[model samples]
Target: MSTDAHPTPEGAQSGRGRAPDTEWRSWHARRLETITAPYGPLSLTGTHWLDDHPDGRIPAVPGVWVQDGEEIVLTAAAADGLTHDGELLSGSVRLTAHHGPIPESPLAHGDRRLVVLRREGLRAVRDFDPHAAARSAFQGIEATPYDPRWALPGRFRPYPEQLSVRVRSADGRERGLGLSGEVVFAYDGAERTLRAVVEGDGSLGIVFADATSGDTSYRFRFLRPFAPAADGTVTVDLNRALLPPCAFAGHFICPFPPPGNTLGFAVPAGERRLIGG
Candidate 1:
């Protein structure tokens, strides 16, 4: 944690202020609760792709899942103990990729949610169970305390058109990383930038690596700056850097850092790794 308050540049202090330590601690607690929730990432036990299992029978999950055009056709017997909307499913139900939260998923087996997920035209089913070993052996996250130096003023420069770059995911599969803009800021007396994606809620999402990566922190972390002002000014707060979902579960396919998103300087703030086990 840095105690020195570096001078906040003019015009940058207008709508942004360093968050109090209490607030950051509260946020961290909430994050822990979210990730450990019943249907959170940590509860994901398996992701079975329909294409990979041509037999339609998924391991552990008691259903025959087959891709039927854009939707997934799930056939279940009463003995399978599968339910949809609290009623035991006796026949079949056509399921499309759930665009909502895991708990809202229509398919359930006891307390587990069988969520249909689609990635690049490939469909899959994710089994989330509250009793997953990863959730049971739960540990807290390790993070550095709030540091004002990691909070810098930045400007968003949107590209004339959206662009994408090929990057490898945590699953070792290459995928396209879409970029909507670049966030330019000053760090360590030098100008630096990161390619950013505009999230659905209009926030800026960035996946980056810093000098501390793979040493004191995870190999990569995520940063989400609030939407930029009309003048393109935004606060780049690295103190809120986050571990990608893959850090919590291997089933998640989180994208790796794209080109030029790796910083040369060490950032000792934000979430590092899971504590305990």
Candidate 2:
């Protein structure tokens, strides 16, 4: 089994002095728990698009899911053993896009969730089973100890107008990824910048790749710097950088980093790769 001492970054300064080791360790533990939880990323087995199956019959998924205007109509039979809200559903239910967590999905067969979703006017259903092989085979995530050099002060420079760029998703389809602005910081004694996406909570989300990408680390990683202060100052803590959802599940359609988001230098800190088969 691969193991890291999980040492704390003693001098990871962000104008808040040293980064708290215990807090980071606790966050790491919770992250592990969240990813391996039932119906989490590892449990996602398939994402079947409704358009791909004109007959509304998806393999291994018991139900007829068809797009009717902006809503999805899911017709289920009692024989399918489908339930909604803890009650057996024997008829149809109008389901719109699911914007919440997977566990709260509207339809289920025993412990498996049939999550209906829509993206860019396309509809689909994701089947998440706790007994998925990926979940059972997951061992651990290889990560490097935190280092202060990766956690630096950065400035968010918002664009005069928000922009959307089409990028290739992990599923090899093109999708629009909205960009709010850019975050600039110093690395290798030179100014480095990355385009930022404003998350639902107004925090700045950075999708980036580095020299270590495709080798030591995953193809890409994510860093979320909280909403800037009054002066547009935010801490770019790569120590807390996260592996993308696609890293854990093949069904996820994680987008590639926007143009110029790849750093030129190697960043040896943060999550690297999956540990076991």
Candidate 3:
């Protein structure tokens, strides 16, 4: 989908009418179920990078993990109590980073899944346990009551080509953020635009902040719009804005908003923070 040269205004009571309060409530309830799930972000306990431990011993985790080219070599003893696919593992095995759901990870230490992850060129292992402290202490997600005014019609304008910008991440590290286009919409009588990245599923992922950030809400939030129509028409719904994964757990390395993605106005909608935390 590509944006047209001229912006198009969608009627307030057109095909995409205001969503009912019950629908928004249901969405919020589902969000809670997802985040508090057993292997969700809240269950993550550690992100152990191999480079940080040259001795091949990960802190607090049994077994030795060493980076071997594009794969990782894990050496364990029977006493380590590590298993692979429910079988006890007492030797060495090579493993590649997992690309699917966390429950599908191969290595497990009791109830914890040792998930391999590769970011940029660095390799790391994430430990996820259902009984993690964060998961246990999770009260709920703080969000504003849904309002129709926060939902606006928008158009997606693709760039001539893809572009990558280096931005600071929540972990205090810099990483590349690939941008494919911008989503433009009218708000408060003015047109606004946000640089967005095309997700693997063809949706648009946006990380943004507003005047309410760091005050009434989190420092930044994320929004993912469905694939645009052939005419680049889409709904820019601020009421569905979400807190990044880092907001649920400190171990997650979520990226921050790219340059110019921060808005000058306040957006009092969507998720604010983890309740009581």
- Give the TM-scores of the predictions, in the order they appear: 0.92, 0.91, 0.92
For model 1, the stretches where C-alpha displacement exceeds 4 angstroms are 1-19
Clashing pairs in 1: none
Q: Tens digit of lDDT per residue, candidate 1, span 1-277?
A: 0000010011011233545566676667767777788877788888888988999999889989999999999999999999998899999999998867789998999999988988778898989899999998877889898877777999999999999788898888887788999999998789999998876656778889999999889889888778898999998988888877778788887888889999998988988878862
RMSD, every candidate, angstroms: 6.5, 5.7, 6.0
How much is the lDDT of residue 96 in candidate 1?
91
Model 3 weakest lDDT span, ten residues long:
2-11
| Models ranked on lDDT | 3, 1, 2
Error of 1 at 171 (Å): 0.9
List, residue by residue over 1-277, the lDDT tens digit for candidate 3. Answer: 1111000111011223445566677777777876888988788899989999999999878999999999999999999999998889899999898866778898999999998888788899999999999988999989999898988899999999999888887778887788899999999899999998776556788889999999889999888777788999988888878887788888877777889999999999988877887
lDDT of 2 by residue, 1-277 (tens): 0000011121122233435555556656767887788877889899899999999999889988889999988898999899988889899988887766778887789999988767788998888999999988999888877676777899999999889888888899988888889999998789999998766556777779999999888988877677788898988888877777788889888888889899999888777788952
The alpha-carbon lDDT assigned to residue 10 of candidate 1 equals 16
Give the top-scoring candidate (lDDT). Answer: 3
> Is candidate 2 or 3 superior in lDDT?
3
